[model samples]
Target: MSRSALKLRSWPLTILYYLLPFAALRPLARVGWRPTSRVAIYKSVPTRLLSRAWGRLNQVELPTWLRKPVYSLYIWTFGVNMKEAAVEDLHQYRNLSEFFRRKLKPQARPVCDSHCVISPADGKILHFGRVKNCEVEQVKGVTYSLESFLGPQTWTENLPISKTSFQDQLVTKEGNELYHCVIYLAPGDYHCFHSPTDWKVFHRRHFPGSLMSVNPGVARWIKELFCYNERVVLTGGWQHGFFSLTAVGATNVGSIRIYFDRDLQTNSPRYSKGSHNDMSYVTNNNQDGIVMRKGEQLGEFNLGSTIVLIFEAPKDFTFNLKAGQKIHFGEAVGSL
Candidate 1:
């Protein structure tokens, strides 16, 4: 192609690029666009398949000579601190999963014994407070229904059916209220999660849905973002009342593994959207269900994910965390 002809063709393209931004600034209504429309488009993305592919890619064994360069690049890009890791040698990790699931030094994250509740994993505190109207805030102002996120309370029976809302039903005792905390894990954060408090897990609800990005930035813009993502909700009782911990899957996290639940699987090939599969830990032999002590390892994700804690606590319960604060596992989250 001639130089003059190439410049002539590129001139119009350059003008179009500058004009596109101005056109986009106009009222989206005039262009038949709404922000909510993005939900549908986001849903259309095959994140499950993409995540599965990423999972496979992560498992590819690296050549011994190339491990340091490859892993160091990732460490540098994500700002991963090797000093905190149990294995400081970058070449020691054979695959990405090994590095992501790396154990921290024993003295690195000391669980706070003073508080009633501690953070479940290493991440940033997205939101935390009382759950009012059965709605828990995903971020500052974005909320998702407590029932929708936890699924129907089908396991609990014998309670008198009344006109009381789902949120009200959760509070078994007077002066007790439901509280929630949302923690978002970045790619550089630890992948394993621990039990935030001493609670008995009676039920597990697995909802297979979209593998959307649970990034704080995305959560702020997308309503009910957590509700649509694949999640495992472990529900039970603590000293106060109903308690539940949910692990939310993200775009590239292909798996959510509960160390205790051997049969539980996530990101399955076939699923019925909007319908959840439930597992009852209360069985004939075991009446109390699975017991989780404070700081006990619970589950892990393939990569970074999100953990949502919704439990019953006294009305006087207060949080030690602040919005957008970087937190580590075993750090104090709240106390009564």
Candidate 2:
């Protein structure tokens, strides 16, 4: 189909696909309805099937004539800047996934050379600050548990208390103080995410949960939104302290592709139902250690999704960020 024809066909479908959630979720959120209620039909099984279908569709190659119009509408709809891409011509990509995971020109995003904490991805900073009482802010008033959010990771057991605020839930065990931030990727933004600092990835954990939307609207309404979603938790640390970078799945996000571990998969049907929370796990321990420099590609969301980073920095560290700030993969967010 031609570009105009494709747009005409796609626009309505696209708008409705997104609008149904907005229409249905907003009111439910306002009324404080649980996300996993009847809404699971929209956010659970069917959405997972849709996501899997979309993933399969993206891999189907179309002829060049059809590709331009289809891909053009996608770029225009998302407002993607082809110039910054490593490959400027959209035709170079074999399929949608190829284009979605396209690399940028090396110089397009310059790495911050100084010793500071950098952004792990190009997206809006939904929340950024300390992990207080073993919880991180989902929105201004909404928060989620570190233990529940990360699932049954061993590190949850050793978190030292630097302070006490929650009655029994040790916020910080003893010497370890945790800080965190949430970065949300919209459809138009760069899809791949990188490491915020030069760090080692010693282990990882994948927790299977709901595939609900992580958009700001859904986040405010859904309790434990991040924890309730399927997520891949990457455990690593710098010289200062331990940290975790969580790749959270959302509606239509079929996969979370990790650069190092190709075996890792997200939004899989195997995890859709049953005792997945207890049965599902992917743990990789690198005794030799897999070290990645600042701005190194860690993984990518097959579609737009969210990344949550949790860590304990040095006593001298201070976050130069706030809620709702826009950030890029190589920009500085804090200094140690």
TM-score of each: 0.89, 0.83
Alpha-carbon local distance difference test for all models: 0.84, 0.73
* Per-residue accuracy of model 2 over 153-181 as CA lDDT, tens digit each: 44433444432443123333335467888
lDDT of 1 by residue, 1-336 (tens): 678766655444222112122223236546786766655566677878877777788799988888898777666556678899999988898987788889989998899999989999999999999999889999998999888998777866632246379988777777788899999998778889999999899999999988887877678777899999999998888888888899999887869999999999888888898989989999889989999999999989988789999988888999998899999999999998
- Which candidate leads the pack in TM-score? 1
Output the lDDT of residue 229, model 2: 79
Model 2's TM-score against the true structure? 0.83
lDDT accuracy of residue 60 in candidate 1: 93
Model 2 per-residue lDDT at 75:
78
> Stretches of candidate 1 above 4 Å error?
1-33, 158-163
Clashing pairs in 1: none
